[model samples]
Target chain A: MQVLYFAWVRERIGVPREEVETSAATVADLVEELSAREERYAVAFADRAALRVAVDQTLTDFDASLDGAREVAFFPPMTGG
Target chain B: MRIVVQDAPFDLGEEAGRFAQADAGVGAVVTFTGIVRNTAAGDLKAMEIEHYPGMTEAALTEIAERAQTRWSLSDVLVIHRHGHLTPGEMIMMVATAAPHRADAFAAAEYLMDYLKSRAPFWKREITADGAAWVDAKDEDEAALDRW
Candidate 1:
């Protein structure tokens, strides 16, 4: 699967985007997997309450299913104008 | 529906005229323009905005659709600028038109709220001391919950 980060989320994770091979089937599972990789990932996913997730291209809840999902994005609540 | 996401400053009058000309069924037009603020109180000198090429547009289009469904809007226009922007510059514009003010106003606000909390754009500010990434505001998320 492909994982993407934007805005300050990208800064916290140290990368803009990446591809991940994971056994995770849900958005929460993917977060746990990435959070285990390093302190940066941990910090990025530190507070799920401050984060927003999108499955494929639609805004979704963290518990949303990701079965066969091609792309998953993690970012803080958007503040665009 | 007309959505223009660009990096240049736009004339509100011209844009409004264009959308008005697109259809005559529109009786009320509600437009919202976001501008760069000179004083942010936080660490900010100048700001730079970045967005995901295809994804940003797709998400914005979907948001416009949602607004359309919720209102009797005859036409919609959304224009968002990218790259570095200074104070007083236009960052974005969202306009909605309907037969009544209620529908036009609701649609415009809905699109703005969704764009504030859901769009995939990032803004970074450079202050007198240093540069820092802008964090999403809790207020933005809360605004969406009202709808």
Candidate 2:
């Protein structure tokens, strides 16, 4: 699976996207696994309320199931018009 | 329906004119263009728009399709620009053509409201001090409740 970040999350995480090998069944579990790896991931995922998630290019919740998902993106709320 | 995600600037007049001329049944065409605004301090150098490559087009198309389902639209056009944009430059535009003015106007507004919050694009305002990500406003989210 690939984990992606955007906006400030990408800045904080220091990378836009990366391939991750995980057995996590849910988005939250994936976050936990990544957060445990380094300080940057921990800092970026520190405030979940300020973040949004998308699974396989579709907007979803942090508790969304990642079964057969190929990509997961985390970013701030969109501000486009 | 047409959705264009690009780093280049788009001509509002040309796009609007072409859209209005597309369908002979189009009785009304409503176009809205969003511009990059300077910060309150009047020091904004540029506005950087970041968007997911694959999801941006999908999200815009979905928004346009939803508008079409709800309104009597003949055609819908959405063009959003990414990358560094200076102040006073056009950022994006939405044009909706319908059989009547009411439908055209309403559908355009609905598309704008949805694009503001639901799209995968994020904006960062660059100023002399620093660059800051624009926060999504509560009113933008609340605007959807009316529809």
Candidate 3:
């Protein structure tokens, strides 16, 4: 699966997207897996309230199951108008 | 419904002209455009908008569809831009046509409220001092509950 980041989350993680192999069952679990890889991921994942997630391009909750998600994105709350 | 996410500038007058003619049976057409504003410090340079390409279109489509279901709209159009933009530049526009003025006005406002919070686009204010991502306002999220 591919994991994507946008806005300051992308800046903090130092990349926009990455392909990773993981057995995480949910979005929170995936965050845990990614955070264990390095300090930057840990820092980016540190404040969950400041972040929002999408599974396969649809806004979803952290407890959302990632059973067949092709992509997951993390970013700050949208400010679009 | 037409949903556009583009980098190039859009002709608001031309778009509005076309939108008003979308349905001859419609009696009212409401259009709203958002412009970039200078920072309170009065040294703002430009605003950069970022969006998830695939998801941006989908989300706007969903919002427009919801508006269609909620109102007696004859047509709807939404255009939002990304990339670099400067103060006074047009950021986005929404138009709704309905048989009555009240429905058209209400639907347009509904679209604007949803677009502010539900859309995937993020904005960064670039000033002489530095660049910073604009935070989503609590009021924008709260506005959605009215619908």
lDDT score of residue B64 within candidate 3: 97
User: Against the true two-chain complex, what DockQ does each candidate achieve?
Assistant: 0.68, 0.92, 0.92
Candidates sorted on lDDT, descending: 2, 3, 1
lDDT of 3 by residue, A46-79 (tens): 9999999999999999999999889999999999
Compose the digit string of candidate 1's lDDT tens values, residues A3-80.
Answer: 999877888988888999998978998899888988899998999988888888788988898898998988876668
Q: Write the per-residue lDDT of candidate 2 for residues B10-110, one digit (tens) a residue.
A: 98999998999999998999999999988787899999999999999999999999999999999999999999999999999999999999999999999
Candidate 1 chain A: worst-modelled 10 consecutive residues by lDDT: A72-81
True contacts kept of 1: 0.81
TM-score of every candidate: 0.90, 0.98, 0.99
Clash totals for all candidate models: 0, 0, 0
Q: What is the C-alpha lDDT profile of model 2 across A1-81, one tens digit per residue?
A: 999999999999999999999999999999999999999999999999999999999999999999999999999999997
For residue A45, model 1's alpha carbon misses the true position, in angstroms, by 1.6
Q: Candidate 2 - CAPRI tier? A: high
Interface CA RMSD, all predictions: 1.4, 0.5, 0.5
* Residue B50 miss distance in model 3 (angstroms): 0.3
